[model samples]
Target: MNSNVKVIEEKILSNNWYVLKKITFDYRNQSGEWQTQAREAYDRGNGAVILLYNADNQTVVLTEQFRMPTYINGNETGMLIEACAGLLDKDNPEACIRRETEEETGYRIGEVQKVFEAYMSPGSVTEILYFFVAEYSKSMKINEGGGAEHEQENIEVLEIPFKRALEMIETGEIKDGKTIMLLQYAQIKGLL
Candidate 1:
Protein backbone atom coordinates (compact mmCIF):
# COMPACT_ATOMS: atom_id res chain seq x y z
CA MET A 1 0.00 0.00 0.00
CA ASN A 2 1.23 3.47 -0.85
CA SER A 3 1.09 5.95 2.00
CA ASN A 4 2.30 9.08 0.33
CA VAL A 5 0.27 11.63 -1.62
CA LYS A 6 2.00 14.29 -3.65
CA VAL A 7 0.60 17.68 -4.52
CA ILE A 8 0.82 18.43 -8.21
CA GLU A 9 -0.55 21.93 -8.30
CA GLU A 10 -2.18 24.51 -6.04
CA LYS A 11 -4.06 27.67 -6.95
CA ILE A 12 -5.46 30.48 -4.85
CA LEU A 13 -9.15 31.24 -5.13
CA SER A 14 -9.72 34.05 -2.67
CA ASN A 15 -7.47 36.17 -0.48
CA ASN A 16 -9.65 37.70 2.17
CA TRP A 17 -10.13 36.71 5.80
CA TYR A 18 -10.07 33.12 4.57
CA VAL A 19 -8.25 31.87 1.53
CA LEU A 20 -9.71 29.26 -0.83
CA LYS A 21 -7.42 26.98 -2.74
CA LYS A 22 -7.67 24.44 -5.55
CA ILE A 23 -5.24 21.59 -5.20
CA THR A 24 -4.41 18.56 -7.31
CA PHE A 25 -2.85 15.56 -5.69
CA ASP A 26 -1.50 12.26 -6.94
CA TYR A 27 -1.93 9.13 -4.86
CA ARG A 28 -2.07 5.35 -5.09
CA ASN A 29 -5.22 3.38 -4.28
CA GLN A 30 -5.41 0.08 -2.43
CA SER A 31 -5.18 -1.73 -5.75
CA GLY A 32 -1.73 -0.16 -6.26
CA GLU A 33 -3.04 1.96 -9.10
CA TRP A 34 -2.03 5.60 -9.18
CA GLN A 35 -4.57 8.38 -9.59
CA THR A 36 -4.82 12.14 -9.46
CA GLN A 37 -7.65 14.08 -7.88
CA ALA A 38 -8.42 17.77 -7.69
CA ARG A 39 -10.39 19.49 -4.97
CA GLU A 40 -11.28 22.98 -3.78
CA ALA A 41 -10.22 23.48 -0.20
CA TYR A 42 -10.46 26.36 2.25
CA ASP A 43 -7.57 27.64 4.31
CA ARG A 44 -9.11 29.45 7.23
CA GLY A 45 -7.08 31.03 9.95
CA ASN A 46 -7.64 29.81 13.50
CA GLY A 47 -11.00 30.88 14.93
CA ALA A 48 -12.49 31.42 18.39
CA VAL A 49 -16.06 31.53 19.78
CA ILE A 50 -16.91 32.90 23.19
CA LEU A 51 -20.09 32.10 25.12
CA LEU A 52 -20.35 35.24 27.20
CA TYR A 53 -22.61 34.99 30.27
CA ASN A 54 -23.56 37.87 32.51
CA ALA A 55 -23.80 36.23 35.92
CA ASP A 56 -25.44 39.10 37.71
CA ASN A 57 -28.05 39.85 35.10
CA GLN A 58 -28.59 36.17 34.26
CA THR A 59 -28.25 37.05 30.60
CA VAL A 60 -26.14 35.90 27.70
CA VAL A 61 -24.82 37.97 24.86
CA LEU A 62 -25.35 37.04 21.24
CA THR A 63 -24.75 38.81 17.97
CA GLU A 64 -26.99 39.18 14.94
CA GLN A 65 -25.47 40.00 11.61
CA PHE A 66 -26.26 39.76 7.94
CA ARG A 67 -24.41 36.84 6.41
CA MET A 68 -24.41 36.87 2.66
CA PRO A 69 -23.43 33.22 2.35
CA THR A 70 -26.22 32.06 4.63
CA TYR A 71 -28.70 34.22 2.78
CA ILE A 72 -27.62 32.89 -0.58
CA ASN A 73 -27.61 29.33 0.68
CA GLY A 74 -31.11 28.95 2.17
CA ASN A 75 -31.92 31.04 5.21
CA GLU A 76 -34.80 33.43 4.58
CA THR A 77 -33.29 35.82 7.10
CA GLY A 78 -29.61 36.30 6.50
CA MET A 79 -29.09 37.46 10.04
CA LEU A 80 -27.37 34.84 12.18
CA ILE A 81 -27.57 34.65 15.95
CA GLU A 82 -24.20 33.64 17.33
CA ALA A 83 -21.74 34.05 20.14
CA CYS A 84 -18.93 36.58 19.85
CA ALA A 85 -16.41 35.03 17.46
CA GLY A 86 -13.66 35.85 15.02
CA LEU A 87 -10.59 34.50 13.27
CA LEU A 88 -7.18 34.57 14.91
CA ASP A 89 -4.55 36.49 13.05
CA LYS A 90 -1.60 37.15 15.38
CA ASP A 91 -2.93 35.94 18.71
CA ASN A 92 -3.45 32.48 20.16
CA PRO A 93 -6.94 31.00 20.47
CA GLU A 94 -7.39 32.16 24.06
CA ALA A 95 -6.20 35.68 23.39
CA CYS A 96 -8.21 35.82 20.19
CA ILE A 97 -11.42 34.85 22.00
CA ARG A 98 -10.81 37.40 24.73
CA ARG A 99 -10.10 40.14 22.25
CA GLU A 100 -13.09 39.25 20.14
CA THR A 101 -15.28 39.13 23.22
CA GLU A 102 -14.24 42.64 24.12
CA GLU A 103 -14.52 43.91 20.56
CA GLU A 104 -17.90 42.34 19.95
CA THR A 105 -19.57 42.79 23.36
CA GLY A 106 -17.41 45.23 25.32
CA TYR A 107 -17.02 42.64 28.05
CA ARG A 108 -13.51 42.22 29.37
CA ILE A 109 -13.53 38.66 30.59
CA GLY A 110 -10.87 37.93 33.17
CA GLU A 111 -10.74 34.16 33.06
CA VAL A 112 -12.01 32.14 30.12
CA GLN A 113 -12.58 28.40 30.22
CA LYS A 114 -12.03 26.43 27.10
CA VAL A 115 -15.04 24.34 26.19
CA PHE A 116 -13.90 22.49 23.09
CA GLU A 117 -12.02 22.64 19.84
CA ALA A 118 -13.74 21.63 16.61
CA TYR A 119 -13.78 21.96 12.88
CA MET A 120 -16.48 24.26 11.62
CA SER A 121 -16.71 22.56 8.22
CA PRO A 122 -14.37 19.61 7.99
CA GLY A 123 -15.41 18.16 4.70
CA SER A 124 -13.86 20.87 2.59
CA VAL A 125 -12.53 23.54 4.93
CA THR A 126 -9.52 23.67 7.19
CA GLU A 127 -11.01 25.90 9.83
CA ILE A 128 -10.56 24.97 13.45
CA LEU A 129 -12.92 26.64 15.92
CA TYR A 130 -11.95 27.02 19.57
CA PHE A 131 -14.97 27.35 21.88
CA PHE A 132 -14.84 29.11 25.22
CA VAL A 133 -17.08 30.16 28.12
CA ALA A 134 -16.60 33.27 30.19
CA GLU A 135 -18.51 34.80 33.07
CA TYR A 136 -19.05 38.55 33.06
CA SER A 137 -20.42 40.80 35.75
CA LYS A 138 -23.76 42.52 35.13
CA SER A 139 -21.93 45.84 35.10
CA MET A 140 -20.36 44.93 31.80
CA LYS A 141 -21.91 47.09 29.13
CA ILE A 142 -22.31 46.80 25.38
CA ASN A 143 -20.79 49.90 23.84
CA GLU A 144 -20.95 48.96 20.16
CA GLY A 145 -19.88 45.70 18.50
CA GLY A 146 -19.60 46.78 14.92
CA GLY A 147 -16.57 44.73 13.95
CA ALA A 148 -13.33 46.11 12.59
CA GLU A 149 -13.61 48.70 9.89
CA HIS A 150 -11.20 46.82 7.64
CA GLU A 151 -13.48 43.78 7.60
CA GLN A 152 -16.61 45.85 7.05
CA GLU A 153 -18.63 43.87 9.59
CA ASN A 154 -21.86 45.43 10.88
CA ILE A 155 -22.53 43.59 14.12
CA GLU A 156 -25.49 44.05 16.44
CA VAL A 157 -24.98 42.80 19.96
CA LEU A 158 -28.01 41.45 21.79
CA GLU A 159 -28.14 40.92 25.51
CA ILE A 160 -30.98 38.47 26.20
CA PRO A 161 -31.87 36.55 29.28
CA PHE A 162 -30.31 33.13 29.43
CA LYS A 163 -33.71 31.50 29.28
CA ARG A 164 -34.72 33.63 26.33
CA ALA A 165 -31.56 32.70 24.52
CA LEU A 166 -32.35 29.06 25.07
CA GLU A 167 -35.86 29.69 23.78
CA MET A 168 -34.41 31.30 20.70
CA ILE A 169 -32.34 28.20 20.13
CA GLU A 170 -35.38 25.96 20.54
CA THR A 171 -37.41 28.13 18.15
CA GLY A 172 -34.75 28.09 15.43
CA GLU A 173 -33.85 31.73 15.79
CA ILE A 174 -30.27 30.55 16.20
CA LYS A 175 -29.38 28.45 13.21
CA ASP A 176 -25.62 28.68 13.19
CA GLY A 177 -24.15 25.23 13.63
CA LYS A 178 -21.27 26.30 15.86
CA THR A 179 -23.56 28.39 18.05
CA ILE A 180 -26.05 25.56 18.37
CA MET A 181 -23.34 23.08 19.21
CA LEU A 182 -21.78 25.31 21.83
CA LEU A 183 -25.13 26.13 23.46
CA GLN A 184 -26.13 22.48 23.52
CA TYR A 185 -22.77 21.55 24.94
CA ALA A 186 -23.11 24.16 27.65
CA GLN A 187 -26.56 22.83 28.52
CA ILE A 188 -25.31 19.28 28.73
CA LYS A 189 -22.39 20.36 30.90
CA GLY A 190 -24.57 22.65 33.07
CA LEU A 191 -22.57 25.69 32.11
CA LEU A 192 -25.54 27.67 30.83
Candidate 2:
Protein backbone atom coordinates (compact mmCIF):
# COMPACT_ATOMS: atom_id res chain seq x y z
CA MET A 1 0.00 0.00 0.00
CA ASN A 2 1.33 3.39 -1.01
CA SER A 3 1.07 6.30 1.41
CA ASN A 4 -0.61 8.31 -1.32
CA VAL A 5 -3.54 5.95 -1.70
CA LYS A 6 -5.90 4.06 0.56
CA VAL A 7 -8.00 1.16 -0.62
CA ILE A 8 -11.47 1.79 0.76
CA GLU A 9 -13.22 -1.37 -0.43
CA GLU A 10 -12.97 -4.22 -2.85
CA LYS A 11 -15.63 -6.44 -4.38
CA ILE A 12 -15.11 -9.59 -6.37
CA LEU A 13 -17.07 -9.45 -9.62
CA SER A 14 -16.14 -12.82 -11.02
CA ASN A 15 -13.93 -15.78 -10.16
CA ASN A 16 -14.50 -18.11 -13.06
CA TRP A 17 -11.19 -18.83 -14.82
CA TYR A 18 -9.25 -16.13 -13.04
CA VAL A 19 -10.64 -13.10 -11.15
CA LEU A 20 -12.27 -9.75 -11.61
CA LYS A 21 -12.57 -7.15 -8.89
CA LYS A 22 -14.02 -3.72 -8.39
CA ILE A 23 -12.00 -1.51 -6.08
CA THR A 24 -12.70 1.83 -4.48
CA PHE A 25 -9.78 3.91 -3.34
CA ASP A 26 -9.07 7.28 -1.89
CA TYR A 27 -6.10 8.84 -3.58
CA ARG A 28 -4.25 11.95 -2.57
CA ASN A 29 -4.58 14.30 -5.49
CA GLN A 30 -1.79 16.61 -6.53
CA SER A 31 -3.76 19.51 -5.08
CA GLY A 32 -3.58 17.75 -1.67
CA GLU A 33 -7.17 16.60 -1.73
CA TRP A 34 -8.34 13.04 -1.13
CA GLN A 35 -10.30 11.84 -4.16
CA THR A 36 -12.32 8.68 -4.15
CA GLN A 37 -12.41 6.66 -7.34
CA ALA A 38 -13.57 3.28 -8.51
CA ARG A 39 -12.16 0.93 -11.09
CA GLU A 40 -12.59 -2.67 -12.19
CA ALA A 41 -9.57 -4.88 -12.78
CA TYR A 42 -9.37 -8.27 -14.47
CA ASP A 43 -6.58 -10.49 -13.22
CA ARG A 44 -6.06 -13.47 -15.46
CA GLY A 45 -2.49 -13.84 -14.23
CA ASN A 46 0.76 -12.89 -15.94
CA GLY A 47 1.83 -14.68 -19.15
CA ALA A 48 4.72 -15.27 -21.49
CA VAL A 49 5.01 -14.91 -25.31
CA ILE A 50 7.75 -15.97 -27.67
CA LEU A 51 8.58 -15.46 -31.34
CA LEU A 52 10.55 -18.25 -32.99
CA TYR A 53 12.74 -17.47 -35.93
CA ASN A 54 15.20 -19.21 -38.22
CA ALA A 55 18.20 -17.07 -39.06
CA ASP A 56 19.35 -19.28 -41.90
CA ASN A 57 15.99 -19.25 -43.68
CA GLN A 58 14.99 -15.71 -42.66
CA THR A 59 11.68 -17.05 -41.46
CA VAL A 60 9.51 -16.78 -38.39
CA VAL A 61 6.97 -19.10 -36.79
CA LEU A 62 3.54 -17.81 -35.84
CA THR A 63 0.20 -19.25 -34.85
CA GLU A 64 -3.40 -18.60 -35.86
CA GLN A 65 -6.41 -19.16 -33.64
CA PHE A 66 -9.85 -17.90 -32.89
CA ARG A 67 -10.12 -15.05 -30.38
CA MET A 68 -13.67 -14.50 -29.17
CA PRO A 69 -13.01 -11.02 -27.81
CA THR A 70 -11.76 -9.78 -31.13
CA TYR A 71 -14.74 -11.27 -32.89
CA ILE A 72 -17.16 -9.42 -30.63
CA ASN A 73 -15.26 -6.19 -31.07
CA GLY A 74 -14.77 -5.72 -34.84
CA ASN A 75 -12.85 -8.57 -36.35
CA GLU A 76 -15.10 -10.27 -38.85
CA THR A 77 -13.65 -13.77 -38.63
CA GLY A 78 -12.32 -13.62 -35.06
CA MET A 79 -9.22 -15.47 -36.18
CA LEU A 80 -5.93 -13.85 -35.21
CA ILE A 81 -2.30 -14.51 -36.05
CA GLU A 82 -0.22 -14.41 -32.92
CA ALA A 83 2.98 -15.58 -31.32
CA CYS A 84 3.05 -18.57 -28.97
CA ALA A 85 1.89 -17.54 -25.50
CA GLY A 86 0.40 -18.96 -22.33
CA LEU A 87 -0.33 -17.96 -18.74
CA LEU A 88 2.39 -18.66 -16.16
CA ASP A 89 0.54 -21.30 -14.19
CA LYS A 90 2.98 -21.80 -11.32
CA ASP A 91 5.87 -21.86 -13.80
CA ASN A 92 8.55 -19.29 -14.51
CA PRO A 93 8.36 -17.17 -17.65
CA GLU A 94 11.03 -19.15 -19.51
CA ALA A 95 9.55 -22.53 -18.72
CA CYS A 96 6.00 -21.45 -19.49
CA ILE A 97 6.99 -20.09 -22.90
CA ARG A 98 8.95 -23.19 -23.79
CA ARG A 99 5.97 -25.40 -23.05
CA GLU A 100 3.59 -23.09 -24.89
CA THR A 101 5.84 -22.99 -27.92
CA GLU A 102 5.89 -26.73 -28.18
CA GLU A 103 2.20 -27.09 -27.53
CA GLU A 104 1.26 -24.35 -30.01
CA THR A 105 3.98 -24.59 -32.65
CA GLY A 106 5.25 -28.15 -32.24
CA TYR A 107 8.82 -26.91 -32.01
CA ARG A 108 10.88 -27.99 -29.05
CA ILE A 109 13.20 -25.07 -28.96
CA GLY A 110 16.52 -25.51 -27.16
CA GLU A 111 17.21 -21.95 -26.00
CA VAL A 112 15.24 -18.74 -25.76
CA GLN A 113 16.37 -15.17 -25.19
CA LYS A 114 14.38 -12.90 -22.93
CA VAL A 115 13.94 -9.64 -24.77
CA PHE A 116 11.63 -7.56 -22.60
CA GLU A 117 8.40 -7.43 -20.62
CA ALA A 118 5.34 -5.23 -20.86
CA TYR A 119 2.04 -4.69 -19.11
CA MET A 120 -0.47 -5.11 -21.91
CA SER A 121 -3.76 -3.30 -21.35
CA PRO A 122 -2.70 -2.03 -17.94
CA GLY A 123 -5.72 0.22 -17.68
CA SER A 124 -8.17 -2.56 -16.75
CA VAL A 125 -6.13 -5.79 -16.93
CA THR A 126 -3.40 -6.71 -14.47
CA GLU A 127 -1.42 -8.85 -16.91
CA ILE A 128 2.32 -8.38 -17.27
CA LEU A 129 3.55 -10.31 -20.31
CA TYR A 130 7.10 -11.64 -20.60
CA PHE A 131 8.46 -11.47 -24.15
CA PHE A 132 11.03 -13.78 -25.67
CA VAL A 133 12.63 -14.88 -28.94
CA ALA A 134 14.52 -17.96 -30.00
CA GLU A 135 16.26 -19.55 -32.96
CA TYR A 136 14.48 -22.58 -34.37
CA SER A 137 15.76 -25.28 -36.70
CA LYS A 138 14.03 -28.01 -38.67
CA SER A 139 15.30 -30.59 -36.20
CA MET A 140 13.22 -28.96 -33.47
CA LYS A 141 9.98 -29.93 -35.12
CA ILE A 142 8.86 -32.80 -32.99
CA ASN A 143 5.10 -33.01 -32.58
CA GLU A 144 2.13 -31.66 -34.48
CA GLY A 145 1.57 -28.73 -32.14
CA GLY A 146 -1.99 -27.48 -32.22
CA GLY A 147 -2.21 -26.67 -28.55
CA ALA A 148 -3.66 -29.08 -26.01
CA GLU A 149 -7.08 -30.33 -27.04
CA HIS A 150 -8.19 -30.51 -23.44
CA GLU A 151 -7.78 -26.75 -23.21
CA GLN A 152 -9.82 -26.31 -26.41
CA GLU A 153 -7.07 -24.48 -28.26
CA ASN A 154 -6.99 -25.26 -32.00
CA ILE A 155 -3.99 -23.37 -33.27
CA GLU A 156 -2.56 -23.35 -36.81
CA VAL A 157 1.19 -23.07 -37.10
CA LEU A 158 2.61 -20.80 -39.76
CA GLU A 159 6.19 -20.49 -40.93
CA ILE A 160 6.46 -17.24 -42.88
CA PRO A 161 9.36 -15.48 -44.46
CA PHE A 162 10.60 -12.65 -42.32
CA LYS A 163 10.10 -10.01 -44.99
CA ARG A 164 6.60 -11.24 -45.73
CA ALA A 165 5.71 -11.26 -42.06
CA LEU A 166 6.84 -7.65 -41.77
CA GLU A 167 4.72 -6.78 -44.78
CA MET A 168 1.71 -8.45 -43.21
CA ILE A 169 2.08 -6.14 -40.22
CA GLU A 170 1.88 -3.13 -42.53
CA THR A 171 -1.10 -4.64 -44.32
CA GLY A 172 -2.96 -5.07 -41.04
CA GLU A 173 -2.99 -8.85 -41.35
CA ILE A 174 -0.94 -9.36 -38.21
CA LYS A 175 -2.37 -6.96 -35.68
CA ASP A 176 -1.51 -8.84 -32.52
CA GLY A 177 0.51 -6.45 -30.33
CA LYS A 178 2.89 -8.99 -28.82
CA THR A 179 3.70 -10.56 -32.17
CA ILE A 180 4.29 -7.17 -33.76
CA MET A 181 6.58 -6.11 -30.93
CA LEU A 182 8.75 -9.22 -31.21
CA LEU A 183 8.88 -9.03 -34.99
CA GLN A 184 9.93 -5.39 -34.88
CA TYR A 185 12.52 -6.23 -32.26
CA ALA A 186 13.95 -8.95 -34.49
CA GLN A 187 14.10 -6.53 -37.41
CA ILE A 188 15.76 -3.78 -35.35
CA LYS A 189 18.33 -6.19 -33.90
CA GLY A 190 19.04 -7.75 -37.33
CA LEU A 191 18.03 -11.14 -36.02
CA LEU A 192 16.16 -12.09 -39.18
**TM-scores across all candidates?**
0.87, 0.98
Q: CA RMSD for every model? A: 2.5, 0.7
Most accurate candidate by lDDT = 2
What is residue 108's positional error in candidate 1, in angstroms?
0.9
Per-residue lDDT for 95-181 in model 1, tens only? 999878877777777889998899888879988999998887745555565676677888888888887887888898988888887
Worst 10 residues of 2 by lDDT: 1-10
Q: List ranges where model 2 is wrong by over 4 Å.
A: none
Residue 174 shift from truth in candidate 2, angstroms: 0.6
lDDT scores for all predictions?
Answer: 0.83, 0.96
